[model samples]
Target: MIKAIVNVSLKAGVLDSQGKAVHHALDSLHFSGVSNVRVGKQIILELDTEDKTTAMADVTKMCEELLANTVIEDYEIELV
Candidate 1:
């Protein structure tokens, strides 16, 4: 079996409203020393196959097709 991990995040120069909200909340709570904040998502998939090449390809395709917004978001895939 192959374990796939997908990380999704907003692209640079794009505004992250959720991240800004969290940063504001943290500041309100007096959590200091934070200069910037960004938010992202992680998706884990367990595959039934053992081929790393195929698994990575499949996961990358998945990201391009549905899992990520290619225009605004970037994704990285890791297999374990």
Candidate 2:
């Protein structure tokens, strides 16, 4: 079996409203030293295959097809 870890994040130059909101909340809570809070998602998948190359290709296809919005978001896949 193989495990695929996918990280999804907004592309650069895209506005991150959720991150901004969290930043504001942190500032309100007196966390002033923090900056550029970007929010992202991690998806962990356990595949039935044992080959690392196959697992990577399958996960990359999944990300390109459904898991990530390629127009505005970027994804990184790690096989374990």
Candidate 3:
């Protein structure tokens, strides 16, 4: 079996509204020294295949197809 980890994040220059909201909330809570914030998502999948190369490819295709929005988001795939 193989474990695939997919990290999906917004591309640079894209406005991260959720991140901004979190930063604002932290400031309101008196949390100082907060510079910037970014929001992202991680997806973990357990595949039945043992081939690392094939697993990586499949996961990447999944990302390009339905997992991440290629226009505004970038994704990284890690196989373990």
The TM-score of candidate 1 is 0.98
**Model 1, span 27-71: residue lDDT tens:** 999999999999999999999999999999999999999999999
Give the C-alpha lDDT of model 2. Answer: 0.94
Better of 1 and 3 by TM-score: 1
lDDT of 2 by residue, 1-80 (tens): 89899999999989999899999999999988996899989999999999998899899999999999999999999888
Residue 38's lDDT within candidate 1 is 98
lDDT of 3 by residue, 1-80 (tens): 99999999999999999999999999999999999999999999999998998998899899999999999999999888
Best by TM-score: 1
Error of 1 at 27 (Å): 0.2
Instruction: Report, for all candidates in order, the number of backbone clashes.
Output: 0, 0, 0
Question: Which candidate gets the maximum lDDT versus the true structure?
Answer: 1
Runs in model 2 with CA error above 4 Å? none
Q: For residue 76, what is the lDDT in candidate 3?
A: 92
